[model samples]
Target: MTRDRFSYLAPWWLPGGNAQTIWAARAARRHFGPAPRWQRSRWDTPDGDFIDVDEALHASAPQAPLLVLFHGLEGSSASQYAVAFADFAAAHGLAYAVPHFRGCSGEINHAPRAYHSGDFSEIDWILRRFAHENPSRPLLAVGVSLGGNALMRWAGEMEQSATQLVCAIAAVSSPLDLAAGGYAIGRGFNRVVYTRMFMGTMVPKALQKLEQHPGLFKREALLAARDLYEFDNLFTAPLHGFRDTVDYWTRASAKPVLHRIRVPALALNARNDPFVPAASLPTLQDAGPSVTLWQPAHGGHVGFPVSHGPFGLPGHVRAMPEAVGNWLLAQL
Candidate 1:
């Protein structure tokens, strides 16, 4: 697929439109139904508190390969994409799991730490535990947006030797450069749309934490902050031990780690992604033998819908689950 810049500017309602606006608007609709049924469990971390993982099983076969799914920032097991993927997996007799990041499982983490776009340690913890417990079963992974970046980074750092159980991996619309992604979204119309919605959800959480812990975060800075950068700089960056947002973005972006992956991995990026700048193209030099950077002509962040029906139906999004599921299953 050719990475066309003009394609990204197309309107979202258009069939196969790759504009970031269209993608964001679809996600904003909230028309998707409740997540599919799944079994929820709390995995006690080495830190004492729990990280929640939701397992959706299609069969009881002891040797069935398990596909572990992860959601985007602030998403839980109930995210639309996660649930849709689970439903797709069920039809194929594939078992899956979605792990909620540290404080996102309706219960605040005991420590001040929360999840960010590039937190691979949490993934490492989950995968190791899952592999150790299910020695005979193979493990695969897929993540969306922020979660995608985390999974990709984890797979890359593994060097394909760390885990004999892992087979294939897929990541969609992950912002390889945090600073660039933030800058792209922090402008003109997009800035308002993104910041307002994101802050509305995040600020309340920060306030709740402040209420519980009293002095855990910067009350004044968080109160005055209006964008993700400000919020992260004051609350997320400091709490995560970064000196500044720029520093965090530099270290947390997955671009530096892409070349290290040794397993079959696919990265899907949309040039029209309003959140990530067009300048941050696939670093061809960094790609390895096992990596396939699938830069489609257009896909607004995650809106790869194949139709113009109500709620992006009858097209790409619906078809993607089957495609992704089949691809992963083939790898196993």
Candidate 2:
């Protein structure tokens, strides 16, 4: 793995990590761009539940590389990063798809099990199916945040076999060490702001899941849960077959197994990312020869807003997707 100097820098106005992260995400959501005419497909799992995939098809480029995106915790196809990547795919004429994790695509999943960060079995099944269906097209996967960690785990688990399934893989702002990230997000300012925002949606969805399968977990405990660790322990960990949050986090983290990844892969994280700490990021010696670590100084979380030209005009919320897209294509 090469610890190359990343080429992304936030504008002068976006000073802190939290500021850069929040501002860029909001800005992207507000700005107008080409929204993909998404063709939604529901694929049934071996279990009774189903997963939804939103695709932007290109029949003209019959054998174009398929870009599969895996969204973060509580994220969907319409997520800011997901939409940005969809725009990039449309502009480049690449076939694109965003696979929503179980219970994440508006509809709650039928099974007792919900998605988690270390759910590589689900990732394996999804990617393998895509490979089988589009045998002619090279598969390239990009996962954001939670999804990224899960995808990296899948790559490591599959090892050399991963190369046959996908030509290249990229992860954006993934918390490689889930324990550190989980701890970080649950404390101080992150807890009050980010945790509250996530819980606003997650808690409701979890309750709905409980309604689907009565006696799943204790209702009072679930409601009392304040942060991710508490919430994961109350809902996510138990539902996903984990003993507790620590067990889930330890087993799910991608850092311990990063050296096992054999495919041409990129793990892009910002040194200033609020969710993922710079100390937790993997070094060149920590990864295999196939991995490249792009730890830029300014990009916060998945946010990579750029300032360009002489005047340093600051209107580039789409920079990370463009850079990631270019890197993925270069592997082919």
Candidate 3:
């Protein structure tokens, strides 16, 4: 697609004309709103890795579908989006689970290598365990940002497998192109805040691993790294067997995997999202009919808010989880 087309599809938000800005403003209000509390639990995988899961059940759902949620990089079950979505599913009589990745659950994994954007093995394990334990119930997945990438890729690869447990899936603000994503947040003020936020989680995880093994990771070099791309290049790339960060991004980006998704999948992307470049998103050709790509003119990153009243919270902003809930119900 041409640059002009990309701009038209994912243009910058202008005053009163930008969905991204409006979404952010509305989401900010809803995000800060009070929410219901749920019980949290930790599950151990067969490989000795631990993941935190938040579960909510409704009285109406004696045998409802399970909606497993995955959060973005450095995000956890505590993330506003994850918790809100879980609550939304519960209201709609669907069971919900949000599994916190490697160290994001407050407890670091036993292994030295931490979770990355395309860490599918843990999610695969979760699916297997859930299926084995609850064979009667159908399983679905919803992912945001990095989690979206991993979930989408896993769905594609598992399309023809014997354990085709997934019935449907959805992802929001997925950085289909990791290389572009890094570039999006690489330069300028975004780099400073986002990079630090990512490192705040990753560095400590690495340090914890270092505290465990002491010799495996080059602590000094990793500590001195400046950007996400550099940090991944030094640690994530080598640990995962790619030549470097570039190679890891090249192989791990989910754009190439969209065509293989056989199950119903909804992917939402916004033109003004800071984390994903509009040009890198998959179109009808890249994503087969099985994948429905939803793009609004404006919604910054994960923000999607609709106005409800002059002073009242926008219904769309409050209804995102409901939107997801409704989608899950449709799949049933």
Best by TM-score: 2
Candidate with top lDDT is: 2
Query: Per-residue lDDT tens digits of candidate 1, residues 198-303?
Result: 8888888888878767888768878899888898898888777789899888888777887888877777777667677667856567677777776666666666
Clashing pairs in 1: 305-316, 306-315, 306-316
Instruction: Go through the candidates in order and give the clash count of each.
Output: 3, 0, 5
Q: Across residues 1-332, which tens digit of lDDT does each residue of candidate 3 receive?
A: 11111112222223322344345533444433336455688787666767777676444355678888899988877675776676676566677778888778787778656777777766688878777776777888889899999888887777655138777788888898899998878777567766777777787777778898778768899889888988888888877677899998988888888888787888877766767777878778888668877776666677665445555434344445666557656776
Q: Candidate 3, clashing residue pairs?
A: 10-271, 19-298, 20-298, 20-299, 308-314
lDDT: which is higher, 2 or 3?
Answer: 2
Local accuracy of candidate 2 as per-residue lDDT tens digits, 1-332: 66654687678877989988887777634223556678899999978789999887534287989999999989988888888888788778789999999989889989988899999999999999999999889999999999999999999999999998999999999999999899999989899999999999999988998898899999998899999999999888888888999999999999888999999999999998889888999988888888999988888888887665466654556788988999999999
Give per-residue lDDT, candidate 2, residue 264: 93
lDDT of 3: 0.72
CA shift of 299, model 3, Å: 1.0
Evaluated at residue 57, the lDDT of candidate 3 is: 45
lDDT value, residue 46 of candidate 3: 68
lDDT of each: 0.72, 0.88, 0.72
Which of candidates 2 and 3 reaches a greater TM-score? 2
Q: Cα miss at 66, model 1 (Å)? A: 0.9
